[model samples]
Target chain A: MRRRPGIGGLQKAAAARDQYRLLGENVAKLRTDMMKEQLATFRSQLEEFARKHKNDIRKNPAFRAQFHEMCAKIGVDPLASNKGFWAELLGIGDFYYELGVQIIEVCMLTRSHNGGLISLQELCNHLRQRRKKDREAVTEDDCLRAISKLKVLGSGFEVITIGKKKLVRSVPTELNKDHNQILELAQGQGFVTVEEVQRRLSWTSGRVTDALETLLEEGLAMIDNGHKDGKCRYWFPCVSSVYSSIGSDP
Target chain B: MASGSSIGVGVLFENAEVTTSGRPVLRRNEVECFLLSSVEFDSEDDPPRFTTLKSGNLILTTHRLIWIPSQSNGAVPSSISLAAVTHIYSHKKSIKSMFHSPRIRFQADPGAIVVTIVFRGKGDIDGFLTKFWECWRGRAWEEEEKSESETSRSGSGTVAQGLYGNDGTVRMVGLAGILRKEQEQWESTDKSLQDAFQDLNALMSKAKEMVSLAEKMRQKLLSAPSSQNGSTDDEEMGSKEEMQQWMLSVGIISPVTKESAGALYHQELSRQLADFVRIPLEQAGGMISLTDMYYHFNRARGTELISPDDLWQACTLWEKFDVPVMLRKFDSGVMVIQNKSHSDEEVMSRIRMLVTKTETLRAGVTASDAALTLKIAPAMAKEHLLTAETKGLLCRDMSPDGLRFYFNLFPEIDPTSQHIAKDFGTYGVWVKATSMLSV
Candidate 1:
């Protein structure tokens, strides 16, 4: 209120602020560098741990889960790519590649009967049966990762849900909403009657008939008219365990 | 099954019902009208002999008035059918009432006993009374009986007309009348279909009618094969069968909606979701992804779509309620709904069986392969495989082709003697399989 500060005073204050900002930035940069170095060291230690406990990691799921937890904390994704430090150290990438080829072969072999729409479980069963004498074990997780990699093929390989079951479609057949709806409804009994669908979905008979015809044409569904109820049962083979066993046997 | 002394006052009422979750069972087409918490049932007329029932939820459904004890320990829940209720006395307004909680009195039968509903917790007293009157006067029970008979008559009448229309002796209606009737039916059906596709709002309104029409057509188709057996060819039969299949898929009669359920939306939605997921869960081998569930549930609900946040909230509330299913989060942060009784051991053992095969030992199996083998979703299959890996049952193999899993041979392999194969364990078998491939 007495005498306002001059331009010289204002300039001096600005210089002090600038100096403080520079100093703060330098300190932050140094801290970041230190953290990066620490992270590098931790990553190498993790690699050593993996090498040391390779046997335990392979033989024990609980131990592997813990090891995975440790990897997560360090922001290390060992499964990100097949060709990295992990691939060289663990030889996992080559293993998945080999499995992918076998999966293609199996899919090709069963394409005729299933019309390229085979349940994942059935495929696994066939794979196991094909190599029953081998001592090495395979799990569904390994199969899934392999399939994800197969997406690059552009060959229309995909996993689709019909009800709760997953079906591996090797073809490029498109399924509309009507088809999906029918598949979902059939999940309860593995089959559905026209009356049941009509009552439940509240669709016109023509629409219901049209959807069912498409499904039948696609060979996704089978017809059963032998019941005493006199109602035709449209059975989705993808969701029916009994149908899988019966259809796959021959 | 606790002591009788802990039980509430016994009221003589007929046909009381309870659900598997210990909640009052609602009749088909019956909707809950009102709910009041901490309601006490007592008769001031018979004080000493009758013990006062306290701290229970009083629910008024379209068909009956039910009171369920808040705690299940030793309380005997009771219900009085609206049909049995003789009269409802007006709430008395006196100087003494100004200091007391809100109360309503009603006279029910079997015996002309006056039952007083004392609301110890806050609720809409007027709304409950109004609904009580409307339900009593409406006489919905009688309508149910009439509708049942009407359905049977219509069903048989249609069958008779459609199947025996060509019989020469039974020409009650002229051909012109039959043709005119058919044209009128077609026009009506066409109008409905056109209206349904006009706009979303129109479709929502016409959805119920569409469902009924679909049901009628299916009924006609069901009897078509039996009546026209001689004229039906293989191609015609095939087309007819296809038509039948389509009609079978359209269902989900009453979907739970927020507007309909109000404050209890999540709880009601959770219950309905539980019932809906049973078949799908079983088919999926006991577990399904939350994303998949969202799609199925919304599709079943039709127009009344729910947000993901609401679904998550409903799933979280399952922990508070005694439900047969549970929500699980994988290490990958992928959420899923699974049966409470679903066991991982069986799946683990199945994986164990799968990996030990000769080809899998040498080449490994991918997640899709495992999904196929386990009869589960690829995502769920991967979770199981990862769990197996963590348990040392399997080890992962990552390659350019894909990620695959093989039975753990690391434990049996002598890491120090890398080039040599131990002649006994899984490692040896794997080595043999690979060598044969090389040959």
Candidate 2:
């Protein structure tokens, strides 16, 4: 109602404020309801879409990854449950599950010589060989998803980044900052001498010695003193190309 | 990691549930106060009956003394309920007792049996006995039962059904349940809202309920399958995820408050955070930036929001506990929470495969390219690439296009015969890959 601009106006303002609060709350609630409705519809549509392109999604790794990305955005995890609608319809859960098992098999097989650290390419190569008879080709996307799921099994399986490459660590050994730095320095020649590490990393001799000794102890580093410079070369087999043949099947 | 339940049968002791990580699965509202590893639980009344449960980890909680085996054996993971304790004998100093492992003796019933706990591990025995005495005298179980009964009495009119609360309110389930509950809540909320505005004091008192109401509404939004309704449009999907994230960070039904946990606040909070992060961690691909974790954790806590310091303290406390998740600091000082068992070999292997591809081997891959290939964030992909480079899996090539990572061929270059390439080695493979690109 129209009112005078005085003490009565103050009362009117208070009433208006209360009304505004209520209106605001209602709007928020309605928005949430709308969002939920939209989500439900999207889920139904996704199921339909998956049904239409099951083969394309399964066979084409790029298409499968794009589909997975779409699922992630909508908060629909086709791999969340092995017995859910998506799993039954797409069998994507079992696909990832089987991939997870094979991943472990590969890690366990290569752990002996690589000292639990293997490159992604080597692991995928082994995996592809193992799954060669299978119809669908597995991609790095599938491996990442499968490995992410493996976190539930404890801290035994994980992916770590060093420099520009990703290393898959199968053991629970922690590579400290210093260890990582030393490893990075060795990337140039597949080996780093103690003096070379000191020159590049600018680390104190004690610190370098401690890190190198720990790496050697972990069996991650192989000592190669057969050099003309007389500098003890620490050859990291996990990082060095010389040992790429380690996990390769004869 | 212990993967499954190994609850064993015991004649004298109560078999308790252990988590996949081999820690005891605490009951509702129960908080662990202290832990002493490699402690043996033996009955003085019958030595042979309790001999099986030897050198296990003794955990003292508000309501029970859980003794989980240090290593899984035929012996069952067991506990002696503090509720059963009849009396605790005070520590005695003697020449003979000083030579042996520190032990605490307590008397308990069904048969008024004397239980002796031998502490063989390196732990503060005196401190453990103090907690044991405190837990026994606290009568926490009785207090819990009393409060539970009071809640039930208040909600006497409730008809018990699926997802029943102690107050007899039907906890909503599914879309229909949510819609029905929404109507009931709105009506009650409207009445309360009007009443709260009547006086300033009333508003202050009603603040907690207001917070809880917000929590309830957030949960409803969270429960609803809103993501399913979004079309194949990317912008809509983005907003849907954003909305879902907003909803997710709004409520934790029973946040571990400082008032509730008191001196054991951080410890309890640590355990709760450990349990809470499993879902979010899985969603984040087993690792989450600490800052993101902080927001998610605080949002889920609703009204009982914690400080950054409190979260930091809780995360740091994880190192002492056997929780499956651990806090890690990157070389750049960015902290992250990840699974304790997250092995780098798994990721490294994948990255290795990525760079060695025919085209990638020649042109090399940028962080964005790696991110696209790996299905991870570009920043995370960069971290992985850096780690791989550090490990000698790849070498960086700084070009106009930016930092591109190529498969390291230095090992295959034999310095004496640098011009020559071996057919069997990756050097030869790289030459073939690059040569094909040139042709």
Candidate 3:
């Protein structure tokens, strides 16, 4: 209408917009830097908290859970490595390394009984028995973390699931599908009958017997033909309930 | 108390249904039409025999008009079947009516009682009334009864008779006639399939029939083995069993929909979902990823697919109900559904057994290795392995060969005596295996 203030006015408006954008970016950058500084201070405070409550974290499961939660909120993984700030502050790495060694001792001692397979609960119980005088209490989580660190050794130490139970395996025998299936079937009552396996799995008698014999040869299963039913039961000691091993020493 | 006795207040509705979460239970096919919160049931009768029920949720369902108290203050939830609602009083618009909360009066039951529903909460009262009128006039309950009876009667009826039209010409009397009829059926089915694929609506309409057909085929397959005894081969039986399993997983007959459940959609969906997950959870070794469950559940639901947010809300609502399954979020932010009885201790013991095997001792296990051994998803297996590692049952090996787990022999190898193998331990066995590899 009135020449619309021409190109000069438009250039001035564009310059102002660019200045505003730059100002906004500068404010955002400042806020981010301030956040980073606050985060660093918060992390240092958390480290202090962890250092103070180290004993409680080691001894009490509930307290340990809370500590882990705090660490998680701050994106700090105490179990990320055996080196660095966490290990330097708490010697948690050495503690697990010691526990891992003790675990191997127990597993080796009881290898003949369970055939290189032991329940995690039983293993913890054994560790507790061995470390009775130790100030730090060992939980399942602690043992698992220690074991994870032991992976660097290249030993065939790992955990496997059979049915609902978790069993620590120290041997390197490959369990075929049939063997795993049989083990899983035996998990419910600690033993599976040849007939029961055949019926449940819809496998022929030959297949069931062959799988059971392989498990037996592998030392993963024991033959139990003591039942009056005259059916042979394949017992997986690793997955059997704790009651079955009540009288046995770890 | 006096009003309670005068109004025959002792269980007015005999079949008073409530879910584990104390939400009103809906009858099969009896969809909820409308819902109004903070409604009061008042006795407008002259004798004032019926006690006024205060601050309750009034629900209009196809089968019944239910009123449940918000708080359990000695007042029982009551309902008036739509069948009993003889007359609905027309809404009277006046200056006084506008000033007060909206109300709807209706004549109900054997006692000639006039009940007034007072909407005290912020709800679309007009909308509720419209649905109530529509449900009463629709008589959906009668249709449901008719269909249920028809299905039950057809259960024992001959399938062939139903498929063929009654032309009084004995068209399918023999094997040859049956073959010819089957060919004709194939042609018709092919045409219907083409029509179904032409549009989404046609596909949806055909989906129900497809589900029923699958169910029928499954029933036949299930009965086939028993009837034939030793006549069927192993391969035939195996394929038949597989087909039956697929048919069993075909669809959920009545999926909970927002329109059908109204305000109680998520609550009802949660309960239904809890029931639905029982089998799948069992099959997944007591745990399954939330994402996988979403797919399985939606596949079962067919056309009424739910959103991820809806599924999440439904899962979250499980805490309020007495459900066997629960939603678990791992430390890695992975979400899964697992049975309450699925103990981590059990899984840990199994893992311990797997790694200690002679073969596994020489060559460590990958996530896929654990998955195959555990009969579970690889991702789930990795979580289990990580959990096992945390428990010190297994240790991880990260090299060019990728991540693998070994039986934690670090503790067994005395760092002070790294070269010397323990005579009776896994370290000795490992030494022997490695030595053999060199040979």
Candidate 4:
């Protein structure tokens, strides 16, 4: 009310403006404090829900039997409310699942590609058959360890046996636990190699590599660029290495 | 890695090692004092061969003799092991011998190269002889052998105590039972040991260098008890306590004192420093503040303490060796020695979970709060929080109340639109958290 004084016009008017400004500052500080408290509450419930959902998907027997390993990236343990915990876990759940698939994908390159080849040599032939641009042969050790990780998750992917030959591919029956964002990021690129996915996402090497390794294991994606036509491709039944071939995790 | 050559009179044989800094590494517990150059050896029974060892430095220690080649070679020069000494000839003052620079001759077998040390550097030759004779008689090699056995003995005892006992037998008693028995043993042992160690005079004379040094200092301080006590107050007492603590840490049985290491002082000191850093490093979760290390290293050194500059030089030398530790200086000018394999990512993830939780988001986490979660000291926890802040994994809250940290929602929050959660980001979770707290 003290903007200016009329005894001399300026002083009374200035006094009125100062009081109005002081009142506005008090209201803004009060509002921020009140909002902060409310935000802290909602956060807890979301975190809890996300965490439990991730765990259920990880431990479910039907799913466990398909992947090598599954883990719910730690969400909230002590301080977060149960609801808040799940929300946080759910946020990153899809990425976690993708890492599992990539591990399986890398493993597939070692065995056989023709009806899942038997040995490293056959795997190399499969990559050679692709004659696709920039496709490389996969090694045995990488495939074995990645598969072994699945078992650590209390789950094992389908290592299909073709007759008596040692041919297996860990396929999660339900691969679409959560991975749309990844597919979105790919921009209809379908399943791709770790290097390609990482480049496209502009994510750190570790994060992309982890997700791609998960994608391959889910059988949602396979290394297919090697073919007689030499066109590097990731093929799926109706989707073409893109059967939404993404799973959050075991 | 070795060969048997004539090894000329001036040429050094095997059993030599040089530190990465191009300084000669010494045998365990060998402390150096006097240094000289152009030194050589000759014997009464051999041919008139003269060792043409040019420009190399000579060193005398209480334990063994040491020599180092120059940096011009781009590598450490070869040195001899004094443990191989077969005989030591007494220096004579005969007419012809007096004309030449003083040289000490000794016989070391395996090839009987009758080593001659030519002292050309400016140092007291008599002091060098005094120390050399003291070192030779000290039998440092034997002590080294004993220390190895002692280490093995302690290691095995702990393992045995886990499975059995020190009597070369497995007791297989439950830990509670063992603790009870040990408690009894300690009480009895403590009394007798205390009684035996009570003599002020005998304790002073017991060849305990650090203890005597501390005792002398303590007595001098006590003489003026109150009249001068105020002047020697808390800081004086702190230093006194530190002196006592150092004397206790020097329990290494035989420290590599300067009197024993000669020209190779800092280099040998560096290796010993490497071995010594392991315990403090472990206690500090594979890393420790350099200031902490400085205190620890000097305490371990006792009377032969080194300066901070030496500690830094030693830590910098770790990169050249296959040692499992390293020295790191944070951008904050806080220097630390960390295990090479220590992972900041693991620590960071743990802290992320800690501060982002509903309670921490509401109340925030002081260094002590992080200490509880990280299971470390508050000071160390603060360093971790600061590191996380720099990495954008966490952020700080400073006000009149206190400084604290909260998990960073930088990745989750849409900074351009703070209120919107983007349907599924960390910011969404954060918004929910504050709401839960308010309710």
Candidate 5:
């Protein structure tokens, strides 16, 4: 104000630097250093978060008990709700599974929760327990590209805006036959995170998180992310329930 | 010895005419009938051997006999005309002459070098002789000379109309005097027509003669009304003038035929057809059908008509000549003669603009409609339309209204998916173009 270089000039210079940094960061985050050892840690922490948040279990004890019994019959722990847990259970690391799981979780979460304008970054955070060095923001372009790929690979997921920022959701139908695999993997390994579904549905350039958002828009599953580490999660109500209520995307 | 005898220097052989292609220019109304190839000419009394014209072709026309060097697969075209063949000596039946190339001895003036026609190639001698007799006897030039005399006489009379009478008597320049002269002319014409139709056979033979008669009467009538100071109605005069013009243009310069073109029949016939087609080819806008020209050409030829096969052979001969007109065959098996400079690109561009227009797009265009716009015959216009369709510049709409053409939209249509137009596209233009229909 006192005759230094004008404020606009200073702001422009700062914005240029910030843009350069943002490009570098996004390019770096696009790299997938997917390793079994690294994924095992993300899996256990994500599972613990989902297990600790038992509001649905407390509210519907009969259903929770039935879910556990089903998991027992399937020979998998119901509390193992992390994406890696599901991927290991299915022996897959692709992102479509994570996306499908994320969409289902979002639908479930939206039924009981309201955090206005769910941003992709906030959703991604809810899907994985990220390290301080790994907290990259999800971009609109990233989300768009990922959802497009999920549509191509026959994933029944969608990304939508509720209150403004795009949030992951599921299509109201499971007409996309490949989406049934998501339910199968989830049932076999208890539950999959939104991140796991997103990873399974990876397009040419889509990150795992974008895949999760798309699946939630399609209502084949349900999701939740209100936990300490913000690891968003998904659980199918029942395969028959989703199929009967939803129609295919022509 | 019949060697080099001419009455005077630089006489250059009597009344000889050659074609533009150096074959032989035909007299007006002359037609080529038949032709023979491989002939030599020498003198009966040991003249210098015109040696081995090696397959030289002889042509017989309605008017004169022609000799052309046979165009073997590849040979320089050389020719000579026989308008001066005044007499033919009786052939000597000696054993030596009989073994030689079937030769005929003929006497020609003014040199009177008893020239011998030696047929060195295989051909029908009686056929050639019959045609030679027919052409020599036809005396076509007599008619031309008579016509030319009448033309000169009429030309001189027009200049003499002011003061002198038909008998070269001086007359006063008055309207009444001119009217009396014109009336006398009309009465003469009326008398002739009455005499012409006296017998039905006379009338049939005199159809062309009637045309000439009408021409004479109309000329007489035209001068009459003007001298009478518009005594007759303008409409009657106008119709009469039109009828006269049609009758006057009823004659063709040359016609191709099998009778006149002896020995070299179709070859010379081909050249004559090529020359005669120039005017009609121009009128048809650089292209015309063979069938059509056959009618116009034969009508102009008068007595000698050509068959369709003769016309085709003539057209095919165009490839051998450096003429301006060429024969073109379309994919649909239609044949035509076109100027060498004619281009499909120009025709295609015209059709492109035609189909894209608003009215043409909606209503489409028929071959006749295109012909009218393109200023060409309907058949030729149909060929252009079909070619345009093949190039994908236009598409055809075949319905009860007959086959019509419209601008093609095949390229504009996206076959991949229902990805709608992206603001500026051929599809958008099409939509805007058709939007007027909606409003």
Candidate 6:
């Protein structure tokens, strides 16, 4: 109560500060303890729920999805360990783990053709082909989930989107905007001439040449000097070629 | 067992089981704190006669110090419990200590043995020592033991045997007994369900028990098919598996919610994202777009979904942490999470191999062709093809047949003598492959 600036007053102020610090520490510790307790209870209850509804969660996709949502909200990773209750009861761990392996096999087998890049739809098609005998349909969502788990191997595995299409990149090669632009433009005919790119992109000839030269150098583009117009065609192999109007009248 | 002399690798310290990947198996609730590579563990005694461990990774956890050899040619994974550590001798600052490799000495129990850790590789010796001291003083093992003992004590009291008959009721016999038991069980389940649905609060509390009933019903359905006939129907089995398959994905049970993590929300979220992205990244073949990640992450999170900005902020913050996954923005402004170890050189070499093939050389591989061969998306294949093109490993050929990529014969063909057939080069190979196709 003494509002004096003497030595005794300073000592009292220091003592009060120390008490406040102690109280704050105690409150923080209490809060952490409470949170830990809540987490423990949540975990136990979630385990019980999963155990009870294992069959339903496994059979009903929508219900299973809801349960997964619940698990996520509570921060429980059912797929964290294969030897756990989740694995024994649901076998969910092995399912995704096996999917991951299948994905790797698919990527490895197709690496020679796509240069380590494949469209999600194409990947799914290959996956379906491989899993023809398998009754359970592997959705793109499931693939994404399984692929997400493979990040532990490294960052070389990733999914990138180009012009509304999701493409899975197995390698670490980067594609610039200019390169992506040219590829997008080439998506229609699977080829773009330097003049066409210059007109469409409204870029200078230098920019177009640099982009086309890069694509050509990267083995992504092939030059067709044999064209009737005499205009050199930079063909992008990554874009699906539209050969419907060409010579197919066998 | 790989080598005769190295049989004593884990003789002195307790034998620690390692994973197939050579990572030391951790005790329940035990967490790794610090890791130092290229460390040697041996006795500090003169001649180091008893035990000698060389060229191993030293991992300091909350409970033990694990030593895993780089290559398992001979050495075994070994661990010393933190409880066994009696004293950690401070580094003696002298001219002698400065010249040699950084080392740490700590006296452990059992034989009161003095263990000397020689750091042959570059690492923070002081930091390791500090963590060592902290782990030792923390006594985390004792807490685990205490909790384990308490659980065992509580569990030992209950010894309920069998179903129904143990209560000393008039046990119905054979089929009648089974029917009665089923009836009672159903009644109990019905009551529990009714109680759960009484109100939202009641449902929340009984949620755990309520969900299990569905499983019981499914199990019954499964057993019904088996009981009805000796042979199982293919359609039923397929449907059952498919139903379960819907819920087969991994769920982050304990997502880092704002309520739980507070001010460390982004940091915790970043760490969790790093862990979460591993599977998807692997599936996507080591890279995934930010948009895809957001969808997957949110889908998993269910209700407590974060905003795009939040996800972006969390990814940007990954640079400050020692996470394995990183936020990579390409020149096209497309953001992706990639492993730090992903190498473009490997992809380039694969592309080089692809284009140089006789079939590909003749026809000129398109993005789809590359996608099929490379086992990647056409978009990604295009990126690689573009990259290969930029490296001058391949050339473009565009026509009515669309775009195609061929091995860059530009470098091998002499500009002055373009028509000359050099029998050895890629040009010659291409000519040979294409001529055969034309004929």
Q: What is the Cα-based lDDT of residue A239 in candidate 1?
A: 47
Chain B only: TM-score of model 1: 0.67
DockQ top scorer:
6
Docking class of 5: incorrect
Candidate 2 local lDDT, residue A222: 78
Report the number of backbone clashes for model 6: 80
How well does chain B match by TM-score in each candidate? Answer: 0.67, 0.58, 0.59, 0.47, 0.57, 0.50
| Residue lDDT tens for model 4, A1-250 | 3445467666656776786677546643443333223222322332333233434322221121111110011111111112134423442222222223333333433323221223333443443332222223334433443344344322224233333444433322121111333434443554454556556655444444333444445333355756686644442222222113223111
* Tens-place lDDT digits, model 1, residues A74-117: 33322221234554355354445444544554665565444456
Better model by lDDT: candidate 1 vs candidate 3: 3
Show the lowest summed lDDT stretch of 10 residues, model 4 chain B: B203-212
Each candidate's fnat, listed in order, reads 0.00, 0.00, 0.00, 0.00, 0.00, 0.05
i-RMS of candidate 6: 14.4
DockQ for each candidate?
A: 0.01, 0.02, 0.01, 0.01, 0.00, 0.04
lDDT of 2 by residue, B1-439 (tens): 1212222224346779975445467776565667766788777676656657787767787788888776666667777788888999999989999899888898887778888889886777787787778778867699679868876876665553211122236454754564566555444555665564454345334533433343443345445454544454564455445446444433343456564445556876887788888888898677766645665675455324465567778999998778889988755445678887764777899988887766667667765456546665444566788889999999997754356789998977789988876776667778887687557
What do the candidate models score in CA lDDT, each in turn?
0.59, 0.62, 0.61, 0.47, 0.49, 0.62
lDDT leaderboard ranking: 6, 2, 3, 1, 5, 4
* TM-score of structure candidate 2: 0.43
User: How do the residues B1-439 of candidate 6 rate in per-residue lDDT, one tens digit apiece?
Assistant: 2343344433446667864323456665565656777888777453333344688777777788888777665666778888888899998789998899988888877667788899898767787787678778878688668867875874565332112122344344654564456456445554665676564446555543444444433343344344344555674455354334335344554455554334446865786787788887888778776755765675455434565557888899888766777887755456788887764777778888887777667667777566656666455677777778888887887865556778887788788987888888777788888787667
Better of 3 and 4 by TM-score: 3
Query: Model 1 compared with the native: what TM-score?
Result: 0.48
TM-score per candidate for chain A alone: 0.36, 0.38, 0.38, 0.24, 0.25, 0.37
Off by over 4 Å in 6: A1-250, B1-63, B66-78, B82-108, B112-282, B285-287, B290-329, B336-375, B397-404, B414-419, B432-439
Across A1-250, the per-residue lDDT of candidate 3 in tens digits comes to: 4534889989988997898677656644443343334334434443444444444333322223333433433333222112345754664544555455556646655755555567889999987754444445677877787676555433346666655667675533331245666766765787888889878877755456655775676445678878898877777654453223322312
| Per-residue C-alpha lDDT of model 5 across residues A167-216, encoded as one tens digit per residue | 55332221122334455545444356755655554321132333334345
Q: Supply candidate 5's per-residue lDDT for A130.
A: 23
Q: What would the per-residue lDDT of candidate 4 be over residues B13-54, giving only the tens digit for each residue?
A: 443565443345654445454556545444444434332234
Q: Encode model 3's per-residue lDDT on B270-347: one tens digit a residue.
A: 977887887878875676656546656754653345655678889999998778788887553456788877858778
Assess every candidate by TM-score: 0.48, 0.43, 0.44, 0.35, 0.41, 0.41
TM-score on 0 to 1 scale for chain A of candidate 3: 0.38
